[model samples]
Target: RQFGEGGAELFHSHRAGGIVLPTGTVRVEKLSASFTELPGFEDGAWWVQDAAASLPARLFGDIKGLRVADLCAAPGGKTAQLILGGANVTAVDISKNRLARLSQNLERLGLSAEIVQADLLKYEPEQLFDAVLLDAPCSSTGTVRRHPDVPWTKTAADIEKLADLQRRLLARAVTLVKPGGRIVFSNCSLDPLEGEALYRAFLAGTADIVDDPLRPGEIAGIDPFLTPQGTLRTTPADLELGSPERSGLDGFFAARFRRAG
Candidate 1:
């Protein structure tokens, strides 16, 4: 709607499926056709991303004109969100192929960002950013609804390894942001080891970081997903839409932190 795509009516008129999200995202409950086959998709009115995938970027809130580093930002959904939110973004990804896809998406949306292909562990920037969004890679157990093969393909060992990798990426993310800047760490793993446990351990070791919890009423339809720790955790069993099949979002977990100045 922000891009003048005409909201749900646009999809309805085209006989497509869509439902509005609190974050202004149009969730297509049932796609009548492929994303490219959907009307206005080629025109870049919107991009394809799960509603849960959109949360981590929103955690920064009102990032207009802020310099933000989007680490591991391939496929560019969150990066596009940052650009549309008026942030100057540098999208860094390790995969060249993925970065190419990200570039194409940005071009289609008529948005631009500094796209860098480099490992987060080895990449160095001239200056720190005002904010950082680390959507770390995980076991992807959260997306089993769409990709049901996730559990079969990924083992518990994979989750453990990914959790360790996320911790390293998160630490690196903190270093890329300036003091007093905020960071939103997120992953699609439902495992606590990759979500709450990892974040808590990081906090225990890092003294200069403080929790920046997501408060109720900040985001519509999000109260049910807020945790006692102030983090956002959405499971496959959450978000009662209407029917069984239409309910719930991807099992995603997100937590925000502010580096002490």
Candidate 2:
């Protein structure tokens, strides 16, 4: 029954019956329908972002006037959050199409950011930032609920390729932060290879990296699977049927790292 390259079509149609968040009371059905039919789905009243994904921006502490760079900021979910938090944000991504979407989202939210379309590996900013958010692309295993197609479309080889890219992106993002600034590296994948594994590797290669902790009670009703070593993860199963509060969130993994003085 698997269809499409890597059986993506088959995987997309198969919904896991069990709810990952057994105690969650959020209504799963209404959330899904709202996302698709919401008036601003395309116009950007709200962007598809996980509750965990919002943690990295908070780790920055305070950014009222600080210069911040959001590397790989296509479709600008994190970028929008940063701007809303009061940082002067600069968003960069390699894909022109996605950048257009990011721009639109910023516009809809009544926020503004300097949008650059360029590969972070080769692009250079005019100055270092107070903080940087590198939400790198990965195997996306942590996002199976929203993107079940990922398991079918991606392979071990694909994960390896993404890991390589993540390393490069991390290296470049490090260079963009000031000596005392912070960098948050995150992905929507559960593979330790993408989440904790890559983070450990980055710390091993660089001496300035330090773990940044999440604020108290930032994640109150989220699924337990989403929390690990201060990182937050969300899955589709976390949404509760019949309840309308915790539904409609995509799975995500996030970690915050600071550049040491």
Candidate 3:
């Protein structure tokens, strides 16, 4: 409750598990606290989410009352982000089961979205949205710390397979947004083939879309992680130089695209 009483690199979990930072996060100082123990846990002050995983949703500066689509959204973190910004979101996920969890989470947080169970590859909306957030499925190499078995279970071939799925999903996302609307494509994979390379290919084929590059200070402390092409790229290797153990952010890549009419 009193986050800033003393500042010691404590972070607040904005439910990618953590956000707000230093003063706020799921934990208090070096101590790991249970979800039930954290302030507002029962009241839905926030959900558990990795700090890095939460960044992509902030790409949209403000969108009060706008229609947005959160594709592949389940156990909805980004969906919550969009809702907090006052977007009327259609949260779509192929897994009806996961969407159930999403619904429960939002209900606890006292937020709501038009939940839909549909596959990103084939689900067709009756109309386009003003914005689309495609946190596309990938090999998830970026989240190895949270799920340690990821690296061991995944291979280059696995990345190729997931990359293909990402490609198809992003292609469908492009179709789902209103002309001149924006799309933020993100994946929790450090692989360029799945993140950066996918964007490059999409650019080549689509004449009506242009890169909506991220700028400096857009998201605090993210300057070093940005690519020359204006995408945020992170890795497990990007931990703070001195404190290798404690200070770290997840490996993630995100790029915004605008459909140019």
Candidate 4:
């Protein structure tokens, strides 16, 4: 049942025997049907952005005329969000193939950005930005509900490797932001090692805590789930247990940081 060429067939064959429901239908079909009905997919007003993933664009407060960089910007969902929020965005990603997809999205939305295909770990822009967002790549555990096949594909060692890469990307992003500018570090991951732990390690030596505005009543009974300083964590259960409309959100974690002046 696997459709793609890259190890997908093996993954699908293995998964086919692992889970079974009363209806005897494939879970993938059910998931696809649910996704197609989501608001973002129909009118194309917005893409499927995790509720928590939207927080980073707001962290900068005012970006109307500011220079912003979205590193690791492939598949450009965040890039589009930033532009809609009024930042003059420069979207960077290492893959030309992925950037092609990003370009298509921008064209579809009638939005534009300086899309650069370069390895952010080594690429440098001619000018610095007022703010930057490093939505670093990581072991995507937070997406488990939407991507049930992830846990079967990834391993603990993969997380460790990604953590190291994230650290490097954060350091580079910090270097690119002006003093007093902001950077929001985020990952679609529930692993504290990749989310909170990565932020803590970065803040320990550079940057400082900054307030993150939460939607009123967003954290009703989950104070412990809130970071000590009020970062946000969107969980699968939070979505699944809510009304059908709310159940469409993907799991995510996000934190905002400010460069020390």
Best by lDDT: 1
Worst 10 residues of 3 by lDDT: 1-10
User: TM-score of every model?
Assistant: 0.93, 0.76, 0.86, 0.75
> Candidate 4 lDDT, tens digit per residue, 1-261?
101122222223443221211111112323434544632333344354455455555556668988999999988878887887788999999999999999987775567999998999788899988999988998888788779998778788888899889888888888888877888888888788887787767677654434343443353333323555667676777633434433434466777776666
- Compared with the true structure, all predictions reach lDDT values of 0.85, 0.69, 0.78, 0.68
True-structure lDDT of candidate 3: 0.78
Tens-digit lDDT track of model 3 for 1-261: 212222212244333233234312333333356646655656666566666777787787788989999998998988987897789999999998999999998898788899999878788899889999999888888998778888888888898898888888888898899888999999888789998888899888888788889898776666777888888887776644565434566789999999887
Model 3 / residue 226 / CA error / Å: 1.5
Ranked candidates (lDDT, high to low): 1, 3, 2, 4
Q: Cα lDDT for residue 96, model 4?
A: 95
List clash counts for every candidate, in order.
0, 6, 18, 0
By TM-score, the best candidate is 1
| Candidate 4 accuracy as lDDT | 0.68
Residues 1-261 of candidate 2: C-alpha lDDT, one tens digit per residue? 101122222122224111223322212223334453643444444455555565455556678999999999988878877886789999999999999988877776667999999989898888999999988988777667666677888888888888888888898898899987888887777677776777777777888777775654554443354445666655555544565544545556666777888
TM-score of 4: 0.75
